[model samples]
Target: MAVVFDRPSLWQRVRPHLRGFDWLLLLAMLMLAGLGLLAMYSSGYDHGTRFVDHGRNMVIAAGIMVVVAQVPPRRLMQLAVPVYVLGVALLVAVALFGISKKGAQRWINLGVVIQPSELLKIATPLMLAWWFHRREGQTRAFDFAVAFGLLALPVGLIMKQPDLGTAMLVLAAGLAVIFFAGLPWKLVLPPVLIAVVGVVLILAFEPQLCADGADWVVLHEYQRQRVCTLLDPTRDPLGKGFHILQGMIAIGSGGLWGKGFMQGTQTHLEFIPERTTDFIFAAFSEEFGLVGNLAIIAGFVFLVLRSLMIAADGPTLFARLLAASLATIFFTYAFVNMGMVSGILPVVGVPLPFISYGGTAMVTLGLALGMLMSIAKEKRLIQS
Candidate 1:
C-alpha cells in the first residue's frame, strides 16, 4: 500500500510555540542600543568615568529588558493597579518629602535616592491599559474622561512638583494608552487644537504681559521665559537662550558630512551644553552630520513601524494597546528632543532615548521595548 503525506509549512509548525519569543522586537531594540553605545563612545570618550557609567547603564537596561520580556501581558496587567497606586502615593510623598534639585522637588529617598516619577513613566501606561481592558467592548465617552482623570492625577502632581518636562512625558505616555484604546478623533482632536491655540496665544503676547509681572494666568515665570526664548534664541545669547543657540550652531556646523567622530569642535570644546544629556543630538550631529542624522531617523522609523505591526497582529486587546503605547513613547522621545534642539519647541529637559546618559530614561525605554516584545510574543503564539 502506498501512503500519501503532506508536509506542514514552516509557519504552521512554528506559530503555536512562541510564548516568550520576539526576535524582531529584540533585533530592533539591540540595533538602537548599538547606536546608543556608538554615540556614547563619542559623547563620553573624553570622560573615562562617564564612558564607564554609560556601559554600566546599558548592562542594567539590558537586564531590565530581559526580565520584562519574560513576563506575560496578563501579568503586566495584574500589576498595573498596584504599581500605579503606589506610584501615585510616591508622588504625594515627593510633594511632602522629596529631594529638591534644579529648582524642583522630584526625587525621594529609598535605600538609594530615586525618582518616583520615573517609575510612573512605565506605570501610567500599565494602569491605563488595565483600565481599558476592564471596560473593553463597552467604552463610552465618559470612559475616556475617566482615562484622562487617571492621566491627570499623576500629571498634575508632577507639574505641581514643577517638573514640566517629566509631566509632559507622563502625559504623552498615558495619552498613548488612550489612543491605543481606540479613542475617537472627536475626543482627541479638540484637546490638541486647544493646546496649540493656547500655546500660540501665550507666545504671541507673553513678553508684554510678563514684563509688568501682573498675575498672568497659567505657566510659571521660568516656563514662560523658556517659550519666549525658543522663538528668538539669539535675544539672550549668553543667558536663558544660550543652550538653544549653541545647539543649533553645533548641528549646523556639521554641514553635509560631519567634521568626523571625536573631531567635532563644538562637542570637544564644550560649546554644546548638556552634551551627554538633553543636547547629545547636537554632539552626534556635529560628529556624524546630516547623513548620520538620516540614518538615526531611519532606525527610529523602522523600530516604531515594527512595533505598530506587532500591535496590529497582537492576539489580545491588552497586548495590542501595550505595543502601540510603547511605539508612541519612542516617537515622543525623538520628537521632543529634536524639536527642542531645533528651537521649534521649548527646552523641556527631555532626554533623547538611549543616546542620553541617564539611568532612569534608559530603563523606562527598556521596559517600553520589553512590553512590545511581550505583544510580539503573544502574536506569534496566537498565529501558531
Candidate 2:
C-alpha cells in the first residue's frame, strides 16, 4: 500500500503558480525599487530612521504584491463592488470625523490610522471596469452616465476633504477605465479643449489674476496660490513659493552628471523640502542627474507599456479596462510628480511611484502591480 502511493514534488505544486508570471514586468518594478532605495539612502540619511523605514515599507509592499498576485483576475471582478462600497463608507466616516494633519482631513482611525482616499484610487477603476463589463456589447450613452456617476461620488467626497492630489488620482483612474470602456471622442474633446483654454487664460492674465486678494470665484484661496506659484515661483520666493523654488534648484543643479551620490548640496543643505517623500524626485535628480533621471523614466515606461499590452490581450472586458486604468495610474503618478518638481505644474499630494518614500503609496502601487501580474498570468494560463 505504501509503495502504491505517488506524491507530486514541491516544484510541481509551486510551478503552476510560477508558470505565467511576467518576468519583464517584475524586472521593471525591481529596477525602480532599487533606485528608490538608493535615493532614499542618500536624501534621508540625516532624517531619523527614514531610510530604514523606507526599506521596511518596501519589503511590506513586496509581500503584499506577492499575496495579491495569487488571486485570479476573475476573483477581482467579484470583489469590485463590495470593495468600492466599503471604500465609500470609510470615506463618509472620515468626512464625519477624520484625523486632520496640516489642515487636510483625509485620514480616519479605526484601530490604526488609515487614509480611505487611497482605497478609491484602485476601487474607482475596479468599480468602473465592473460596470462596463456588465454592460458590454449592450453599451449605451446612459451606461456611460452610470459609470460617470459612480466615479463622481468618491471624487466629490475626496474634494470635499480638499485632498486634491488623491482626488486627481481617483479621477484619473476612473476616467481611464471609462475611456477604455469605449467612451466616444466627442464627449472627451470638449473638456480637454476647455481646460486648455482655461490654462491659457490664466497665464495671459497672470498679473491681474494673481494680484493680492484677487478673487478666483471657483478655486479655493490655497488652490489659487498654487496656480500662481506655478506661474512664477519668484513671486514669494521666501514664503509660499519656497518649496517649488527649492525643487527647481535641486533639479537644475544636477545638470549633465549629478553632483555625485550622497553629495547633493541642495539636498543636504535642506533646501529641497520633502526630500524623502513627495519631492524625492528632485533629490534623486540632484544626485543622479539627467542620465539617472532618464533611467528612472525608462523603467516607468517599460512598466506602463507592459501593463497596457496585458490590457490589450485580456480575456474579458473587465480585465482590459481594469488593467488599462491601473496602467494610467502609474503614468499619472510619474507625470504629475515630475511636472510639479520641474515647476511645470502645481504641487499636489502625489507620490512618484517606487521612487517616493511613502508606505501607503508604495502599498497601493504594490497592489496595482499584483493585479496586473494576475491578469497577465490568467492569459498565459488560458493559452497553456
Candidate 3:
C-alpha cells in the first residue's frame, strides 16, 4: 500500500479519469484550433487589435475546454434545471430593460453587457435532456408535448427579443434533444410540414409582403429586406445587396487553386463586410480557393462525425442527447456561415464557429467541446 501511495505517476491518476478520451475527437478539435488561428491572423491583418484579441479569446477558450472536459455528465445533469431556469429568467430580463444595439435589444448589463441567449444555447439542451431522461422508458405523448413546451418557452422569449438567429439556434438545440429522446415521427413530421408550407407561403407572397418601403408582419424591415436581397441581389446591387454581391464575388474570384493567400483583391480592398466574423469564409476562400474550401468543409465534416460518434457512445441518455444537440449546433454554425458567404442565405449575424472573432462565442464553443470530451471520456471508462 505504501509503495502504491508513494510517488504515483501523474498518468496513473489521469488515466483512470480519462478512460473515455477519444483521440480522434481530440485531433479534430486541435485541427480546428489551428485553422481558427490561421483564419484569424489573415482576417485580422487590416484591423488592428482584432488579431491580438482573437488570440486572447483562443487561449481563454482552450482553458475553458480543458475545464469542461473534466466535469462528469452526471454533474452536468444535476446543473441542468438551475441553468435552464436562470436562462429563462435572463431572457425575460433581456426583454425588459435590455441593452439595445443596432435596432435590437439582446443584451443585459450585470456588471457587463452580456448576451444571455448564448447561455440558453448550452442550458436549453442540458435541461431538456434531463427532462427526457427523467421520463425514460415511459415517455408519453403528453410528456413530449410538455417537453416541447419547455423547449418553446425560451425560443418564444428569444424571438420576442427579435433575435431570429439565436432563437433559431435555441430551437434547433431543443429539437435535437426531442429527436434523440425518441419522440414520435408523427409529431415531428407535422411541424416540419408546417414549416415547409410557411416558407413556401412567404416566398410566394414575398413581392407584395416585402415590396420596398412596406411594413412587415413582425420581422424588422431590414430582416425582410435581407431575405428579399437573397432572392435578387442584383436588384439592389449597390444597396442592401452589397454584402451578398461582395461575398459572391470574393468566393467566385477564387479559382480551383485560388489567387494565393492575402492576394484577394476584394478582401484586400475591404469589399467584404465583417471579414473577421460572419463572412470570414469568403476571405478564406479568396485566399485558399476551392481546395481550401474543401479542406475547411472536410474539417467541419470530421468534427461533426466525431461528435456523433461520441453521442452514440455516451454512458447516459443525457450525455447522448446533449452530445447530439451540440453536434447539430456545430453543423448549424458552419451551414449558416457558408450559406451567407456563398449568397444562398441571408447575412445574419451568425459567426463561423472557432474561426470567428468573438470572445463570447469562443467561450461558448469551448464549453461545448469540453462537454464532448467529458462524454467521450465516460464512454472510454465504460469500454475499459
Candidate 4:
C-alpha cells in the first residue's frame, strides 16, 4: 500500500515555540506597564507629548522584548565577549571625544547619540557569567580576580564620565554576578563594612566636609553637596535642596488615599522637579497615595521574585548568573529611585524601571526582561 504523508500546518509548527513562552511573567510585566502608563498620564498631563511619547517608548520596548526572547541562551552566551569588548571600546572613545552635556561627557555620537555605559549594564553580567560558565567545575580564586578586573574597567570608565546613577547600576549588576558565582561571603563582608563606616563618617562630619572651599578628595564638589543635602535638605532649601524638598512634600501630602488622578497640587504647581522622569514616583504617590504605592511595590516584588525563580531553574551556570544579576538590576533601580525621592538616599538621576519615562532606560529594561524570558523558556523546553 502507498503511504500518504501529511505535513503539519504553519500554526502547528509554531505552536511548540509558543507553548514554551512564560506567560505568567508576561502578565506581570503587562500589569506593571499598565500601572506605569496610568502614572505617566497623570504626571505628564501638562507636559507636551510626554504621555504619548512614553506610550510609544513602551511599545518599542515590548517589541524589543519579543524579539530578544526568541534567541536561545547559548546564542546569548556567544555574544557576551563581543558585546563587552565593544562597550568598553566605546567608553574609551567617549573619554577621547564624547559629547559633553551639563559638564558630563557621557554620550558618544555615532550618527546617533548613545550612552555606552548603558550597554555595560547588560554586558557586565553577561561577560562575568560567560567567564564563570567556562570555569564551571574548575573555578578558582584567580578566575574571580580576572572577572573583577574585567568588571572594574568599564565601571571605572563610566565613573570617569561622572554618571553616578549608571555607575551604581553597573556596579550592582556586576557584584550580583560575582555573588551568585559563589564568591565567598568573607570577601564580601569587608567591602560592606567599609561602605557602612564611610557613610557614617561622612554623615557625622557633614558640616565640616561640606563647608565652603572644602574639597572632598574622592568625590566631586557637586557629589559632596548631594550627600550633604541628603543629610539636611533644609540647609539650602531654595538652592541645592529644592528638588528633594519638593519631592518629599508631594509624597507626604498623599496621605492615605491621595488627592485623586491629575489632582496633585505639588505636581500641578510645578513643585516637583523632573515630574515625568526621575521624580515621577512623587507624582504617582500624590495621585495614588499609600495604597497605590504599596500596589506598585507589590508588582515590583512579584516581578523580582518571578525572575529569581527563573534563575533558580536556569539550565546552565551562565543562564542562572545572568538571570539573577538582571533581577538585581531591576531591584536596585526601584530601591534607589524610591529612596532618593523619599529623602533617604542622595538624589542621583536613576529612574524607576517601568514607571519612569525615558526611552533608553525602557529599552534596557525590556532587554533584561527578554533575557529572563529566554532563560525561562529554555528551562521549560528542557523539562519537557
State each model's C-alpha RMSD to the native. Answer: 5.6, 1.5, 2.4, 2.3
Looking at candidate 2, the ten consecutive residues that score lowest on lDDT are 1-10
* Count of residue pairs whose backbone atoms collide, per candidate: 2, 0, 3, 0
lDDT of 3 by residue, 60-90 (tens): 9878887888898999899999999999999
Which residue pairs in candidate 2 have backbone atoms (N, alpha carbon, C) closer than 3 angstroms, thus clashing?
Answer: none
Clashing pairs in 3: 20-376, 20-377, 20-380
Segments of candidate 2 deviating more than 4 angstroms: 1-13
- Per-candidate TM-scores read 0.91, 0.97, 0.93, 0.96
- Which ranges of candidate 4 are over 4 A from the true structure? 1-17
User: Each prediction's Cα lDDT score?
Assistant: 0.84, 0.92, 0.87, 0.92
Compared with the true structure, model 3 gives a TM-score of: 0.93
Query: Per TM-score, what order, best first?
Result: 2, 4, 3, 1
Error of 1 at 166 (Å): 1.4
Candidate 1 lDDT over 307-329, as tens digits, reads 88988887778777777777887
Stretches of candidate 3 above 4 Å error? Answer: 1-19, 213-216
Top model number, TM-score: 2
